[model samples]
Target: RDCARPQPRREVAAAAGVRAAGVRRAERGELRAVAGFFVEEFFLGRTTDPTDRARCFKSLCADQSRDFSRRYGTSDSAMLIAEDADGELIGCVGVNFGRVPAPDESSADGPFALVANLAVARRGRRRGLAKKLMAAAEAFVREDLEEEEAILLVDQKNVPARRLYERLGYKRRWADPDAKALEVVDGSVVAQPVLNLCMRKNVSGSAGALVENLRWQDVALLAAIVAGVAWRDRLAELADPLSRLLDELVTAIPAP
Candidate 1:
């Protein structure tokens, strides 16, 4: 379910300063920009292990594209792009509607649609481009692909992203149990042990529940954990201090 086809529209609109949208074939040239966005902007100065970041992105793209092609066959996966008036690549979001194979132990029926690998360039940050891309992706899934629901994973600490997802009617479906947990230690928290939050949004239901479920304290703590781990990769050293802080905060909360 991977599409390796070249999408000339993406290149043309990206070069022409107009907002371009499509699920056309991805070209080799497009990979350079996509890879660059993840490496230079997304993981810049954050990861201690640069090689690991590179490997992760490569593996993610390969896996996603393969699934895209396998399921759609003649149809390509959707990749929405937003460029500034100058025609530079400002934002990009990829959508895959291919079904994922159920695990051996799972009883889930067929494959599910997933939206992943969303990134917007630094200068393009703050604009409503991400929202537009999300809407388009949802529409594609519901109307075009006829999927009942769409799912995505976000870093537990990415506050802005979490907010965006919540606003878009997505809810925290589950926490990745295998993900490393963050704890406080010393006077300052150390990095390492990151967690990922999984979310799902039904296009047809009320989107308000997602926002109501968000707790500011939880979001802030998660953000801190993500920042610490993403920047320094040391978490155990911060666990003790964080635990104390958590205890204090818990005490401050009015008992039910």
Candidate 2:
């Protein structure tokens, strides 16, 4: 949706086929695994040159270590991870509750959370880990951090990532006017015309109120009521009591 007028913010899509049960904020012990995943997937996966790869790995390792340390101690920022049933790390993402480092003129001037460094393993691809990670991050932003908006940057050439974000309610509103995309040609570095697209989503609505705020009993009761409607034709006797139970439960829950 880049180069188009702003559209209404969409709800976060439900995750499907994720191997891990859920995503959680990273702990200190998981720092190494998180760093290694980023280096392998984002850095090492990009090049075949041994020297460049080695240097880049070293540099990225230190940078990611410092970044993890910085975000771990802060209450407003977090690095989230998803592990498989075997306890092996499979997906990771980070969110920082603050203003963008350098926002473009066309962007909003208010503070917004930035979602960064989202990565999924090769084996975990096509299994919905990314969506789960994003849902949790946005939940943290709205329910935990109490922020109204979330933004992210993706390379213009990375069509898959861009499409995924769009499906998750983000729109490519603008690009960082001052940012440059660079590539090493034969021997010299040249700047490309494609800028990093800054996509954003508004997360202030009550899209996930029940999932985030309701108790287990409330959810179960609601689910049972919905299911009861399908069987109303066969067993008309149960419909009235189910309706009464739903009414009682709805009255008990406070309005937002």
Candidate 3:
């Protein structure tokens, strides 16, 4: 029992009738699934051109795998995958450290970690797996990487993910201008693209102050639409209520 072999610290606690473990480096097979999940979930939606989508998916998969290896293998990146007792990959979280430099020259400044490609299998949702993976990622950044801050970008439409990140102390930093314009074209909002907001949170700072500075009304509106659709069988039945809720939420928060 006193052998010198290094062991991975169990990053997830048992919950909801399941126990989870962190996937260690050199686990190529699991990484492939992680890559595949991103391709299917996020990238797939953005590409309409079949050829472009195919190329993008290929590039993404290869790049992601390489990225994972470079990060985990070299200790420059931190990734935590949650697996059930039966050895099934249920969820994963990844943080790319030092992706951006801090604006201030403070040694207390942490690496600009980009959280991406997080996914929990369909059947594994609501079991607190996502939180566990995120906690592990945060611990790695805070403790192992000695980072004082972490950052991530979530789709403006991903209300659930946004809520989860917020609960975990992630705030919006800045929204993509292009994404804002696209939303307008898609008939989501009439506001100028330049006014789009990005939320950000300093992991070491007060969560309330961080959230108070950003515009999360859009997210709230989107959440209403999602909830309406989930409850009603048709969009028509939910359209008016959803739209009204969006308007109220957006106007509820003044520009800060």
Candidate with the greatest lDDT versus the true structure: 2
Q: If scored against the real structure, what TM-score would every candidate get? A: 0.52, 0.65, 0.53
What lDDT tens digits, residue by residue, belong to model 3 across residues 1-256? 5886643454234343244545543354466667666554544554466666666667667866776666654556755777677766667778776443333354223447656667776556777777777767766766666666667766666789888877765665555545432222231223344332333454443565455534467568778999987777676778999999999999999999
Candidate 1 residue runs with Cα over 4 Å from true position:
1-29, 45-76, 98-110, 180-193, 204-256
Encode model 2's per-residue lDDT on 21-97: one tens digit a residue.
46888877777668878777765665777777666667667877787777654778788988776566778898885
Report lDDT per candidate. 0.60, 0.73, 0.61
Model 2: lDDT equals 0.73
* Candidate 2 TM-score over all chains jointly: 0.65
Residue 216 lDDT, candidate 1, scale 0-100: 69
lDDT (C-alpha) at residue 215 in model 3: 46
Quote the lDDT for 218 in model 1.
Answer: 62
Worst 10 residues of 1 by lDDT: 181-190
Model 3: weakest 10-residue lDDT segment is 181-190
lDDT of model 2, residue 128: 82
Ranking by TM-score: 2, 3, 1
In TM-score terms, candidate 3 sits at 0.53
Q: List the residue pairs that clash in candidate 3.
A: 171-199, 171-200, 172-199, 172-200, 173-199, 173-200, 174-198, 175-198
